[model samples]
Target: MKVLIIGLGSIAKKHIAAINKLDQSAEIYALRSNPHSKSDIAGVIDTYNLNDVKVSELDFVLISNPTSEHFSTLQQLVEFDIPLFIEKPLFSKINEETQSLVDEFEKKEITTYVACNLRFLDCIKELKTILKDAKINEVSVYCGSYLPNWRPGVDFRTVYSANKEMGGGVHIDLIHELDYVYWLFGNPDKTNSFFSNTSSLKISAYDYANYLWTYKTFSASIVLNYFRKESKRSIEVVTDKGTYYVDLLKNTIEFNNKCIFASQKRIADTYYNQIEFFVKNILIGREKFNTIKEANTILKLCMKD
Candidate 1:
């Protein structure tokens, strides 16, 4: 498969790494607005300019650009009617007009999948399996950490995660939680939230967002942030029968019976799982493992709400 990766940043690197690991022969070309002269992968592969690159030849166009720039970059892409993997939030801010673009993509039979990496987490995939028969009443998640600690070399202030206009911040950045939570639950209407950039760390964008979601039959809350001493990512699902706890990094799921008897399972990586599912759907006429319509809908809520 031939693929063109845009914005050779962190996620782009991870995507390349994940793709190569999955399929060594997947012809990969990368593009970035600003290429680092000292970067290791700089010389080994060819990088193309947006103006020069022919979009139709590429089987997939993966846009890993900053959120705010997504719409404009998408503008350049929409004309080609090719499959795309757009990273997270459809746009920094959503409007009626943006919906039109999404509608057009669908009308033209262009498939677009939002890259919500958490959706590819082993824990969540199993949680979905466990809840397949059980009746789920609620779901909650906790994800937060220091922004400066996120990257090994860059300053937090200059990184895309710190700029609200660039779709940086807990609300937009960690918003995959919101998107996927809706995927697990349904649409959220009774929503109350408390989010702000409290620390002097850099008050450009909201660093924290705590959401209290009131579903029709269930309830949920998520505490997300770019502030903390330690890094953490966890999810808990409470059904009428029992509770399922997932420790993502540890790749373990512990079922607690009043905090007494329990069972746990360690999960293998699901990164390639998500990629293979996508590739299969593209190659064959089989049903897609994930839907772009659903993704675009969640992206709507993330950008608008």
Candidate 2:
């Protein structure tokens, strides 16, 4: 199988490594915006421009570029109607132009999957199973880390995450929390959000976001930030019986103070599993994994407009 990955950033490298490990036979080609971008993947092909190669010839395309460039990149390849695995948040911000491109994909019946790898986590999957018959009252999810600690040796301000135009912010960059909230429970009836850039970090975008989503059956609160000294990511699902605490960073699920599931899986396993499922299910007509429609809904919630 031939896979053309757009953008050679850190996330793109993870996809390449995961795909290659999953299927040694798969040929991986990278489309990088920066000519100087480096790839750790051995023996993989690289291209600076999309015109240099035939995008239609590839089996699938993975858009791992900066959020700001996603719309333009999709516009260039939408005509090909190739299956796409787009990164989360859709774009830095949703606008008429990007929405039109998504509409075109839907109208053409193009097969596409949005990347929200958090949904594939073992702990998350196990929580879904445990909550199948259980009742929930409220849920709280949080993901926070020091901006500079994200990528070692690289200035956090220089990366796309620090620039608002590039779709860099806790709201968009940490959209996995939003996606999973929508995944576990449907859209909220009402949304209240507070976003600000009070951090000392020299970023053009907001460094903090706190949102409250009220659903008919239950309520959810999400917290995202780039100022936490110690990295932490966890979820708390409250129910009529008891609150279920899930430590995502440790891959542990506890219900009523008892550990239920403990996953020994690595973080990369989520990417591997997501790509594997997408390839097996999306390639064939079996089922649609993460449709653009659903992604758009989550995107709007992240925007909290």
Candidate 3:
């Protein structure tokens, strides 16, 4: 299989790792906007000049660019009819241009998938099974970590997450919280959110955001931030019977004072599983990973006020 990755950022590297692990014979190509950004992965990744590579030549394309540039990039590639595996949130925010591109995808029946690797986490999968019959009332989600700690050598302020215009913010960057909620409960009926730059971090984007979403049967509260010294990501679902907690960081779950789900596997396994599933199931039309249309719905929910 021939695969082309449009962005060579950290997430793109993970996807490349997953792809290589899945199929050793697959040829991997990457397009880097900055020549200086090139790393010494020549044998593993064949770097291509964006203008020289035709979209039709690849089996599929992975769009892992910064959030603000996603829609414009898609507009350029949507006509190719190749499968697209896009990174999450779909866009920084929805606008006419984005909606128009979505409409084009719909019209084209594009084979598209959006990345929401959190849904493939062992704890999250177990939590879904536990909540299948529980009477849910409220769901609370949170994810926080120091921005500078994300990429060891990169300056936090220089990344897209540190700039609002580039779609750098706690809420959008940690949107896995919003995505899992949508995956578990579907779209919310209404939503309101508060954003703040409460941290001492010298970034233009909000350091913290809290979102409240009301559903037909329950409500949810989600919080994300980039200032926490210790990293944490978890979800708590309250029910008439009890509360179930899924610690994504620990890959464990507890319900009614009982240890229900626990895993010792590396969290990176989720990325592998997600990519494998997308390739084996989604490509053959056996199952659907998160689709672009569904991602747009989640995108609207993320932007709700």
> Highest TM-score, which number?
2
Q: Give the C-alpha lDDT of model 1.
A: 0.72
Give the Cα error of residue 125 in candidate 1, in Å. Answer: 1.3
The Cα RMSD in angstroms, rounded to one decimal, for candidate 3 relative to the true structure is 1.7
Ranking by lDDT: 2, 3, 1
lDDT (10s digit) by residue, model 2, range 1-305: 89898877778878887888778988888887779876667967888878887877888999988788878888888888888889876877787877888899889988989998989999998888888888888899999999999899998888888888777899988999998888878788999999998788867888999999999888899999999999989999999999899998899999888998899985668999888888888776547766887798788888974
**Cα RMSD of predicted structure 2:** 1.6
Candidate 3 structure quality by residue, lDDT tens digits, 192-243: 9998896799789988999999998998999999999999888888999988
Name the lDDT value of residue 79 in candidate 2: 87
Q: Clash number for every model?
A: 0, 0, 1
Per-residue lDDT of candidate 1, residues 1-305 (tens digit): 77888777777777777677777877777775665533456322566576666777877888887877888888788888788887777677767767777777778877777766666676676677677788778888888778888787877888878987667777788877887687667788777778788786865888988888887777788888888768777788888988888776666677873332222433234556656666676534445433456666665555443
Question: What stretches of model 3 exceed 4 Å from their correct place?
Answer: 35-39, 45-51
Q: Which residue pairs collide in model 3, if any?
A: 161-168
> What is the Å distance of residue 59 in model 2 from its true position?
0.9
CA lDDT of 273 in candidate 3?
Answer: 95
Candidate 3 TM-score versus the reference: 0.94
**CA-only RMSD, every prediction:** 3.2, 1.6, 1.7
Residue 197 CA displacement from its true place in model 1, Å: 0.8
Candidate 2, residue 62: CA error in Å? 1.0
